[model samples]
Target chain A: MSVSDTHRTIDAIWRIESAKLIAVLTRIVRDIGLAEDLAHDALVIALEQWSQNGIPNNPGAWLMTTAKRRAIDLIRRNKLRDQKYSEVARNTDLYTEDDMDHNLDGEIGDDLLRLIFMTCHPVLPQEGRVALTLRLLCGLTTDEIARSFLAAEATIAQRIVRAKRTLRDRDIPFEVPAGEELSDRLSAVLEVIYLMFNEGYSATSGNQWIRPLICQEALRLGRVLAEIVPYEPEVHGLVALMEIQSSRFRTRVNSRGEPVLLMDQNRAEWDQLLIRRGLKALDRSQKLGRPFGPYSLQAAISACHAKAPTAPETDWIRIAALYEALSRVLPSPIVDLNRAVAVSMAFGPDFGLQIVDMLGNESSLKGYHLLPSVRGDLLVKLGRFDEARKEFEHAASMTRNERERELLLKRAAECNSAH
Target chain B: MRFMFIVKATGYSEAGGNYNQKYTDAMIAYKKSLAGAGVLVSAEALHPSSTGIRIMYPSDSEKPEILVGPFLADQELIAEYTLIDVDSEADALNWALRMPVPTGCGEFKIEVRKLKKNLGFLRYSGTCALEADLKDQLSMLKNF
Candidate 1:
């Protein structure tokens, strides 16, 4: 194979293997920073040696073996500097077993879960936890994480640095929080996954409207998370929400990659299989018999859309009620705006306009482009062409997505010509 | 019309020193109000002037000059800014007047400047087609 071809193969392999390698190493090393270094060291070795020796048939095992050797070397060399070495090293049977590979595979889920919990440790800042988790657990580079979050690379890099240091200095255990602590930590983990999915669903700031790769990674993570913690209703709720939302990924953007608004999208293009899976997950969450949390409520909202044959046929009344419930539980102006949309569809533009108009002075919505967009839609429905034109133009300016801006501008122009 | 509210730096802010929690709280509250009103366009807090750099082009085109700060005009340096589109200059001024003292010091100053109009000067041909091509190129590059 050509050198570039070898490098490409190695890159793909690393993405699949690196997370498992780091999770397993973090289990042994008990230090995220050190575990990451060891995993990186193994990757450097793979890049150097794989080109010469040809790619190994058992590449994961090869990386694992290489990383474990490095761990042993690190423990010996930095035995004095590293407190973790002293703690885990004293236990001779920790990583030196002949059946270490089998053992690592056996406890891989636990290690991955532990890694998730550790990376999302509550002590670290929210953004930091997310940055670190994406870096280690999802095999995302700092640049990818920054782009996904619509943040600067330097900011993400610093957050990761601070997170790893906090993990070490605070001696945050490399295990899932137990008892009362478990649910709180779990929420943060779920949040990180959801954040990743949201970025994919509707990119916050980018030329492209949807980032399917990010959504796919998030869905994979959520599925893995669901497998690890089957009893958690919220986990199922979150998974259901992502599945249903992701079902429309193909329809969300047109052949030209322009965004298709929910009401305008071709319903036939929505993925039925994913919708079924999402409904099943929602049912599982409901069967748990707990009060519906934010995720399940949102999933319920999405399920309403999935069941509808057409946008006009959608159960807007039920969605409005769900958003009302969501506002009571997870109150935010965004929810209020969404509820306004549902209310407008279910009842009339006037009813929704009242709610939206009340939020005119809402401080949180000032920089929010969607508020103007939603208002513009309502105004158009109300036959206020001039007002609608202004709102659309305002929204177009606020939007960072190039296609979204273009669509908004098109709407503004249409309103202008009509007026 | 859109106006830019420039927050002038003070001696306290330029030293890279920490401020009281209430100072940050007030700033957050101010930003929240701007966002809530549906008038705010964009906002950002600039880093200390020490980290800033300026490139000066020579008239003769022999060479460009690069200048790094701590620029001597520390007091004149911008600490932050917010852009807002309001109905009138008076409306913009009202919002600017309502802005909280950034450092909780009684003597904070903010300057609001109206942006130059884009309509007259930006009548370029094939702008949409060019922008579309550029957008495709950018999206393609983003995957890396």
Candidate 2:
């Protein structure tokens, strides 16, 4: 292989092995920032040696061994420095090479889980959590993570550096939380993953509607988490929801790059494999015998759409029922709005209009464009063309997406022609 | 992103030569690792070219031509393929590089190609930003 090819191979190996290497090193050193530094040190060493001697047979193990050696050397140096400074500091916990060897083999899965929890800890800001998670758990470079989020590379680098510092300063334990704390911490982790997925699934601020690469990364991370925490129903639930949603990615927009509503999407074009995988994940969540959380409830709703042969054949009643259950578990105006849409499909536009009108006074949804959009659709169904046109125009004005605004204006025009 | 790793057919593979126990064990272990990472979408080995047929359109007329295989050029034919969904091309390459070498099968090649997914909006709307960002990121990776 050429020099560039060898470098690319090393980079690939680093991507695959870095997460595990960092996770293990953190456990040994008990410092996330230091662990990362040691892992990178090992990577630099591998880049030099692998090109000379060819790649190792087991690259992950090779990297781990190299990183562990560096960790031991650093600890020894720190111990010597501490001994010269103060006698009391000599008693601090430090691992020898033998201790490191004993601790390295097993519990790597647990170490990774702990790493996820640490990165997604509620102590850090949401953006920090996201940046840290992508950096530590997904093995993404600062540049790649920056590009994925459409942020500046230096900003991402600073965010990562600050997040690691916070993790160290706060002295967060390198273990998964337990008891009631476990569920809360797990939700934080799930929220970070879901946020990453949504950032890709729907570009809230960009001209592009979908960023498939970010979604793929989020889905891969969710899958990894699900394997590590198989008993956590919500983990499987989140995976199921992402899988089902991702199946529609191809059909979510048109050839001209206009948005396509769920009902208008081509059912035959939806990816069957992903839908099946999602259903299987949902089944796993159900088998865990826990009450459906927000994600599972949503996945159950998506499954209803996936199972339907066509839009008209969708089980709106079941979906409405699921939405009602979801509202009780995780009440929000957005859930209520979705419930209203399902109710309209299952019952009548008047019934849906009543719910939508009630949400008119919802302070949280005052600036939410989807409210007016849904209300407009119901008003049109009820033959209130004038009101529907006004609502669509309002929605069009409120929306930030150029394509969605165009769609809303088109709806308003349709209402005008109908009248 | 999703990638397909296509293992090219070799003379030994085309002749249906059996793999030794060591190679078979290594291949199984490699597949297990792929599944453990939750990246393996599907993997399958194809039957020899003799079992396959190809349909071709003759350019001069509307008529079609059917050809039976035992086709020429073993290097051009695929013996097997594994599809994996990963975070990036680098991650896919990482997995591909770890694949066990097939011993006593002469030399073989695994070609990696990304599966195309619909990103019409990104292509049409964010072409400049996306291409420029990707180029910048590639250069950054090269520096590392």
Candidate 3:
């Protein structure tokens, strides 16, 4: 492979393995900041070596052992504070090459959980916690996070810096909170995971439609959370949601990264195992005998799609009813918008339009592109080609994303060409 | 993130007629989902633009001018709107993409734009004017 190819390979590996590497190092260094630095050092070494030596068979193990050794070196060279020395020494003795290879190859979830709680400690503000969690847990670069939220890069950078400093200065314990505190902090934790998964499933604005790496990280976090808090229905709900969503990851975008509507996507590409797992998780949520929450409701909706043999066979009525329940439980314009879709599918385009017409003056949706896109679809159904073309044109102009824009413009062209 | 879904007014809608049950049931369900998500901040349908008044602020600002509706209504259509709080633009887009058609006649348009939330910096300064001016930019007045 070329040097650039190797570099790209190394970058992909780093995104996948950096969380575990930093989590393990933080346990040894007892400082999140220092742990990240050590992990970066290991990554730098990997770039230098992998470019020359070709990629390793077990790149994650290579990275972990290297980082651990660097922790030992920093301690040996007195670069680290004296307080961290004994812990580093303990880590050095315990994480022999073979041991680290075994651990990274197996049970690194515990470290990941501790890392999550530590980053999300109530000490930091909620935004700080979110920013830090994405940075540490998902291994997203600051640029990526800022782009994801449409926030200034400087703003994101400042938030991350302050978050890390607060965590270090406060000397936050690197362990999961218990009891009442656990439930309180757990929501924040879940939000972060959900955001990460969404970022992976459908990037906000980027060249690619999805970033599978981030989604996998979130799924991992969700799964681990479900394991630790088996009784928590929400955790299972989130896991099920992510699992189901991810089953469609392969079919979400085309080779050129264009968006594909669910009905138009190749369902055969869906991962059956994941769909089964998601259904099982849903069953667990139902068995809990509690009313469905937001996540569970969405999972239930996705289940409808998964169970369908084809797009036309999807149970739009059941999905519509579930959406009704979800809206009653927690109402929002977006939920209402989705409900409009369910209603349309269960009923007809005209019915959906009536649902959507009331929202024409929705202040929040005034600038939203999909609103126009959907309206255009309805117009086409009504055979108002010129007006449909205009709506599609309007939607095409509103989006900052290229793939979505292309899709909208293509729709506009179809409307223009319609008889 | 916060976004507003705007439905543009068309001449046909201004005639003032009740939408059918298909539209009604779908809309009811749609609104319910928004409520269920707990992200529906506000939603309201504008009376056909003819029922509205336009106030224009000129550069000289000698006096605020007012004009009546249905003047070039074809050119200016602000029909109805719904606001929501979702995870990101992508989430808002997904929700928007799934919305039922909103017009009984020909075509309708709904536009979405992000709403500026009270960022940490903005909250500290409490400056709403600057916030409005900087709404679409990357300058976030957020603090940790």
Question: How high is the CA lDDT of each candidate model?
Answer: 0.77, 0.79, 0.74
Best-to-worst TM-score order: 2, 1, 3
For every model in order, what is the iRMS? 18.9, 21.3, 19.8
- lDDT per residue for candidate 3 within A203-307, as digits (tens), equals 523346555555677897788778767777878888998898888877867877765666667889999999999999988888888888877887898899889
Best by lDDT: 2
- Listed per prediction, chain B TM-scores read 0.73, 0.77, 0.73
Compose the digit string of candidate 3's lDDT tens values, residues B1-144: 668888776666687655666876887789777665445656787777667788998999878899887556564577678877555689799878766675557776778888785453112111221121122110111100
Which residue pairs in model 2 clash with each other?
Answer: none
Winner by DockQ: 1
What shift in Å separates residue A177 of candidate 3 from its native position after superposition? 1.4
- For model 2, what is the C-alpha lDDT against the true structure? 0.79
DockQ of each: 0.03, 0.01, 0.01
Position A125, candidate 1: lDDT: 60
Candidate 1 vs 3: which has more DockQ = 1
* Model 1 per-residue lDDT at A183: 86
Q: Rank the candidates by DockQ, best first.
A: 1, 3, 2
Query: Regarding lDDT, does 2 or 3 come out ahead?
Result: 2
